[model samples]
Target: MSTTLHIVLAAALISIGGCGDDTTPTDTGIADTGAADSSPTDTGPTDSGSGDTGDAMVPYVPDWSCLGSVTTGTPTAATADVTATFTDFGASGPAVGASIQYCPWDDIPCASPTDTGTTDSMGMVTLTVPTDPDPYWGFVVVELTETRRHEYYTSVPVVNDATPSALILNDAAINVIALVLAETQDYDANGVIGLGALDCAGRVASGMRIELTTGAGTAFYATEDGTFSTSLTETSTAGAWGVLNAVPGDFTATAFLGADSTPIGTINFRVKAGEVAGLFMFPTPDGAAYTP
Candidate 1:
């Protein structure tokens, strides 16, 4: 692959602004970027059609294969403090008295809680979970009667980090997500894909565009406020990106400036019809821009 690699598409161990206000979380250690360019960026999302790369408009074909995956929540611990916050999307507020549980990533309808807690006045609960050398894929299970459904499940990438785990609240803004639901809506188990572009330091990004490798007409984008856009001219922000009604399966996507075909890099991930997946976007390590 002679093309310079700029961005890294990783399974958001800490998906979509996963970490809350903590600015100094360690590097998450994303790697294999080829001489990342120190350029200015405005990250965006991908959807159904290809942007004009100024070429012959041949269908976009991803030149890169799947690379190794990166998991954060590092400096593994035997036990860690995992904090989960429950929010009320309709009212734009936090909840009180919500319940939570922990389960291994492979478990569904979790057999039982690995650890448990109840949200306090602030809707936050800290659970002590044992950690391992590798990050835990699925942990915190949130239970709240305020939403359309009584349960919300997520993978806490910050589970292994010494610091408190990232906030596992609902996407709250973006809709059509397989897993993200609002207080006013019914839970839909249909498939959808979303991305939260950010810097290695955990800052959200905007202005870049994401494209599906399949050209399957599944592209979609949204802003921080949760509105959706399918126009080729709109750029996706750290706010949101993905296929609203996606074709479920393993998929590949490339990141680039809005409407331009030059890729920052390619990301690989799987999306089942009924789960929420957030893809993390990173620019070169020099802080080219953000998700900084």
Candidate 2:
């Protein structure tokens, strides 16, 4: 008995032949010779119409979406529970362990974030907003990958339940810090008397009345309790005060003594979302003016 081993490079074929029991060779179309057969029909990988080039090209498509239940109030509560679920485009599994952030829609320099957290094992996060006020339009950001891919969800509206108002995009919250002294004196002799009345420690004004209205004099903060509740007269306690929500633009603030209806000082200023504007009210020898 004789055995022959044949190796061919052109068609990448190997064959074995022997004169034993007349077994048919597995390498089809190859003669029972041990020489390399480099034929025209046996072209290598680049052979035309050979159908062995490679896998077909598939274009890359992004996978992203926000999944979960999100709700907003007419006048959003001071605090509310918010839940978010992140998933890939197919919505099959969670985008696990991603970073998430909630930015107030009205925040100027929109890059500034209001709240931040990370996704859980199930690609979900529950948030308890600490400073949520009425008209809470903002953005929710998800960092999808380690390569810095980002997804931004915008125009989320939230408002206080009691004094419900529609959320306005690009608007801001204004905090008015009032310094009320018992006397009509400059309190401090600085020419800028408003900055001089800085006795917020012991002389913190508890019931100083304040009002914020549109440039057209339409009062927006008319509630008595003064905490975004429209039914209460908004007042100050210990100099920390605020107009919970307002459109981003020009507006006027009026200050009065505790429980006094008379407007002692008034100032007009522009407000921006997620920003603080400071003003000082002093009832002094001069009639009424707000400095700073």
Candidate 3:
């Protein structure tokens, strides 16, 4: 079987497509990528403007009070112990330093007062009050200063009631002597004659007596304790004895047995030159040579 051959040839066709279309939109929110926006906005630190803000500091205030007591009879035969305490009002902790000043209530110049002291957690101070024959009154003032404020405390009126039994001779012109007499003797003795007797009897007399003398030959006499104290306004000389003007000279004080002038004993002493004089005397032994 014979078949007819037919050949058909088609040319290769090539078509070029355009670039792909871009549909995704570009970013407009970025500052550099777009124009600046005009909307108003809040920034910087947050501000609520409320009352419970910042730090609160406390203010300082001072309030003080004083307490005091007195103990009678101290250093002197009659003296008193004065104590005072200074405290702060509403103070929970210990107080700072404090000062206390005391003076005679009647004294205007403030003679001798105690010094200031610091409180030892407890505000307290004590001082000695001298007793005087004349009534004395005084006050205690305490002061304190802190970083915040100043405070002051004052005590009520204080008085010294003690009385001194021993006489104080401060005068330079006066000579002082103390004597304790024996039970057998009735009078207190002093002067040179009293001193001589004190060596024998051991005990003297206690008391004071005054007398006047002309410094003449007339011998001055003391009866009680064999003490003789006499003041001479002018100087004079009697026989072999010579007495200087206003010169206090002590002589052997002699006590007689009775009005008969029998010599009992002599107390020896020297007079102090001045306005005042003191002497002590003692009892003498029997049969002792009595020379007037």
On residues 1-292, what C-alpha lDDT tens digit does candidate 3 reach at each position? 1010000000000000000001110111100111122221110001001011122211111100000111111222245544433333224223446555555533333456543344455554555555444223343333455321121111111223211000111211011111111112111221111111111111111121112222111222222211222332110110001111223443333433232343333333233322212222222233131121
Task: List the candidates' TM-scores in order.
Answer: 0.54, 0.27, 0.24
Span of 10 residues, lowest total lDDT, candidate 1: 1-10
> Candidate 3, which ten residues in sequence have the lowest lDDT sum?
7-16
Count of clashing residue pairs in every prediction: 19, 20, 19
lDDT of 2 by residue, 1-292 (tens): 1011000110111000000111121111111111122221211111111222232212111111101111222332466445654443222245567776766644534487767888777666664444343444444444555222222321123232111001111110111111111112121221100100001111123344556545321122211122222233533221223332334565555555544464434444444433323233322112232221
Q: Would you give me the overall lDDT of model 3?
A: 0.22
Worst 10 residues of 2 by lDDT: 10-19
Error of 2 at 163 (Å): 22
Candidates ranked, most accurate by TM-score first: 1, 2, 3
TM-score of 1: 0.54
Candidate 2 off by > 4 Å: 1-73, 90-92, 106-111, 130-133, 146-148, 154-156, 160-292
Which regions of candidate 3 fall more than 4 Å away from where they truly are?
Answer: 1-77, 90-94, 106-117, 147-292
